[model samples]
Target: MATVLPEGTANNTAERTFDSLNPATDEVVGTYPITTPAEVDAAVARAHDAARFWDELGFAGRAQRLRKWKSIITRRLPELCALVRAETGKPEGDAQLEIVLAIEHIEWAAKHAKKILGPQRRSPGLLLANNAASVEYHPLGVVGAIGPWNYPVYTPLGSITYALAAGNAVVFKPSEHTPGVGKWLVDTFAEAVPEQPVLQLITGFGETGAALAASDVDKIAFTGSAATGKKVMATAAQRLTPVVIEGGGKDAVLVDADADLDAAADATVWGACANAGQTCAGVERAYVHEKVYDDFVAKVVEKVGTVRGGSDMDAQYGPMTMRSQIDVIRRHVEDALERGGKAVYGGLDSIGERTVQPIVLVDVPEDAAAVREETFGPTVTIAKVRDMDEAVARANASTYGLGSAVFTRGKGVDIARRLRTGATSINAPLSFAGIASLPFGGHGDSGFGRIHGPEGLREFARPKAIARQRFSPPLSLTSFSRTKATEKLVARMMRVLHGRSR
Candidate 1:
């Protein structure tokens, strides 16, 4: 029998329930109360009520509370990791790493929120020179977050931590596959600020998430599949609500002819197999210079063969949390095989009941589904090119451009900048995710807006510009009293400041 949620739990609507299973054992671990539409609305209303109190606290007070919360999370990091591992079936070490990184983001946001979101003076321009102008960021009241199961802690915390630091209350709806992780985070925040409902959780299936999107929240921050992101945006359009969508990625890693083959292979193995290849920025395709293609493929195959997947401690990877993902992984492998791609390490039979061993493919046609789409599995398709130019062209051919990496010794930075993605790292894979200062997001089909660093704080707050006249100017332009002489002066100033020839 499936587990049932406990009655009278906080935020429980008692309308429906869903089971969270241990991916490794296929045993039901726990049941979460599926919130109804009314409950989602109630959570939003409570967030609005809490926002007034939270916004009134200002930056310093809010920063202090965030610091305290950060301390709490840091001290209990292991406990939280256990919950994450249990709910998401990720390795314990990986879970711990995500929590640590999340804490770093929280600390950084708490320390820098004021500097990033505070009021600042701006030039009123010559036309409004008589008026003093300043702009300040205001809270968006309540923000609703619909997160993903992979990297459950880090992905959602990217939005939640920044939103709270910006003085906006949050109503988080974690992935149905990982509600326990969500509940643990919100419960910890509640312990820090028991007086107000600043952070709340509403757990349920897609309907509950849809309800939250359609509700009256000021903004919605969603991190999931691109398809669901489109649905969320469509629903929010009804009320014309603002949203920041951090969807999927088909990111690639380019290895130039001058690159170190061994280092490139190591990075590829880790990037493709880590977290069971569930990372949004994880490398799904690899473009290698044909000059060194054979050496790179051999090393990657050797390295991937050393890694295995299981729930046991000795294994390097774990099982697929969602059963439906098995079919997708199998189909991608089958498609690649049929399209003339050679599987160097594993094949279609490598996909087990729950665990999927790492699969490395080489000589894959660029148009293959495995190369063109977001597999979100521990599979990588590597192709060969004649030069750096061809490698770059093949890398940029995809529709999604979230995060990418380059492994050349000297030209890594230049190549990284030209990848048409949001974030890129040189010599290392997924290193940008660790830096709290750089903005994390994507472009094109990967989704719009950002959710980390300064951009994240600004995303949760609306800019409010204040202008007040301090003194009368020698030449006025706003009033009807403006003369041709004043217009001529303005024109001359414009020509001086913004002339066609610099």
Candidate 2:
């Protein structure tokens, strides 16, 4: 794989580098340059220069290029998925699913950027009735996106694609674990828009990421652990660079008594185990109504029992993308077990060399690490709640609230409203992530800012407000010419409009 290098470093034979390994077999998939701080600066400078051309392209010009990029990705779906599977160690289908969602987001961002970010008329209000006001979103120049390994394509592109569509150049530093996948995306983007390096890639370890954060980018978009997010924020603080951090999530699921048990079980199991539960928004803990706790637990356990993780094609999922996370899974399971939790399905033995089989823990205390922290493994804790009220309370009691799910026949929407998460799915798990029209991101420890939807398109751009005088105001309140009478009239108007007893 070709690693995009800095201008002066092309001939440096002694440049540092690192190898990306396939988590399953520990085989070296590819080697990437450990981009130096100077190289990162070079990339950011190039992005800044490119941003001028990109911004001048205007909405229609940018959308046309984005659509071409999207079409290239759609046609090469199989090839991209193969690279994703090789780097991330996820099942082929799972990789494809993420790419498909990414493609949809690219389409949405391209088609909607004009409508969402274009200039729009705003009501002038009574005081300025003669003035025409409008707001338009302009690109933030250059965006520095630091992606995560688990959902490399879908997550990073969430920022990269949208930033490009909004007419900004992007300097992306994907996860060290999935550099190949990141390189593939950048390469394909070059294929689509070769005139300018609107999107560039720099691969390395945490040092490289920090360099990009501290660089002179207009905005920093990071997806990783909250601890790391804090570090990114601190680094970017030096420049006062704006940032959107999509941090870790300890998402929950609420199963109401009236929920379809079979459907709920299916959603919960798939949500918890899909991609080996590496999903930031995956169901890490679930609260079931007492009336259906026993039945729901049985269903979840039975489904989890049959699921397996391996490198084979028939495996339900593949190994953990990052081998170090294996210990985190082990510790959480042990902690839950020591805290009186019982494994209804796979247990301690499920934790393997690089893969974790589905493990469902019941009776795990809400305060247990497994239930409170982001395990990022195929393990979920189920607890019984007396009522939906209790379930909602317990579910909302988390520092990280990225995404959530509520299963019910009658109260799905109502219950979803009470959730403190970024996005909540009714009768399903992770449904919000697939919808390009819905914004993604979370509150508190889950981080702030959104990534998908109309809100997402606006995230990378700055709003510019304009007010033009359509005609001179008859009252002439601002003029020194007879302003007292106009001021009195304005006060009376304010009273009539706002000072109402009703």
Candidate 3:
């Protein structure tokens, strides 16, 4: 019943719109409006008005509404997951997993916002003993969230739910490739809090996203490529608006000599190929100790042997949501082979018009694109290292340090701590993202700012510090009426308190 146009296409007789297609079938799944710059600005204006009402609903009231929305999503999980599958071309199981994670985040943000953002007393210290101080987080007026197509539901909601829980209104701009999923989330949220447009949606291509970044929103939370993230930052700089950019990662997995060969292999295969390797933090590189390198590669190659990517129901994963990625995957794999890498499993022929078969290349040069770039596809490059030190060194050499996993018995946490990544899973791949209490983000080119946990709630709010004079100070330092004697006393006291460390 609904119709739309492609990106940048204009309609002579009606409002401009675009169609979202099923990546697997190449069939139109749904259509959404091609929201223009004017519409994005108007949406931001509405969010500012709604922000006051939403913020006034204190933590308790906001939590109640958020829980209702959570319940709605949980009860209709299957229906929403089905829509996600159709729109994103991920398998139904993968789609369900994404929704389940999103629901968990919503519940966590609702329950913890008060404890994390409410007013808290602070010690004034000896220098200001007469003053009582406290700090509370106040919501930013409005947040602009630009989401990615991969893991569309879970990823965007990370920003959306936390911002709402922090008492800020949100304007979400989902990737054009998955507009239907974005619309579904906003529509359902409205049903829960019909009183205000607390969460709104804007759909289109890059132009729409650029407009959002350049809008009057208080902050921008973006998840996409590093190059694109730079553009968003440049645009937001025009207004000097703050932003959180989760650029993609060339994440790595470190396999130690004492690690469980089988388990490490299994984690590597799944981490590298899951959701057709569309994940931003997916494992793109593996550095295994020379002692266990051969065994780990053997097990991983065996595990990948059973993996399949296609439109069939039995397939392990679905087609590439963005078709352009297929060529990128092909190029990376070919480049690795040309540079003397050996394909332990699939190779150049594994890349297809739609889906990519699991490809495992061993002995790939560290400087190869397959190892250095964020190849968002079902591929991984494995290299042998002399020891855990070398493995850690190679893993930390990447310019993008979003996520990493370290597999070892006694040194799991130690190795994890040594790696320079936003979050590291000690024994499991991407385990940090599943923990609702842990803040998830990255360093270096993978982008900055955080989502999830208390840090996430604080990301969308500003800390307002408060101080009150409860009594007269022992030293009247504020007054110049008796400064000569007071100054001498103050200098003596400062030396006594700060000149030496206890």
Give me the candidate number with maximum TM-score.
3
The superposed Cα distance between candidate 2 and the true structure at residue 38, in angstroms, equals: 0.8
- Candidate 1 local lDDT, 1-502, one digit each (tens): 1111121223344546777778887567678888888999999999999999999999998998998888899889889888887877888998998999999999999999999999999999866788999999999999999888899899999999999999999999988788888998899898888889999999877678888998989999998877778888888888999999888899898998888888889999999999899889999999888889889999999989899888888888788877778888899889989989889889887899888999998767788889988898999999888887887888888789899999997898888878889999888889999999888999777899998899989999999989998988888777899999989988998888888785
lDDT of 3 at 353: 91
Which should have the higher TM-score, number 1 or number 2? 2
Q: What is the TM-score of each candidate against the true structure?
A: 0.95, 0.96, 0.97
The per-residue C-alpha lDDT of model 2 at residue 34 equals: 81
- For each candidate, the alpha-carbon lDDT, in order, equals 0.87, 0.89, 0.90
- Per-residue lDDT for 488 in model 3? 95
Ranking by TM-score: 3, 2, 1
The segments of candidate 3 whose C-alpha lies over 4 angstroms from its true place after superposition are 1-14
Clashes of 1: 0
Give the Å error, residue 203, model 2: 0.9
Among these predicted structures, which one has the highest lDDT?
Answer: 3
- Give the winner by lDDT: 1 or 2: 2
Candidate 3 residue-wise lDDT, 333-398, digit = tens:
889999999998999889889899999999888999999888999999899999999989999898
**Model 1 per-residue lDDT at 112:** 95
Candidate with more favorable, higher lDDT: 2 or 3: 3
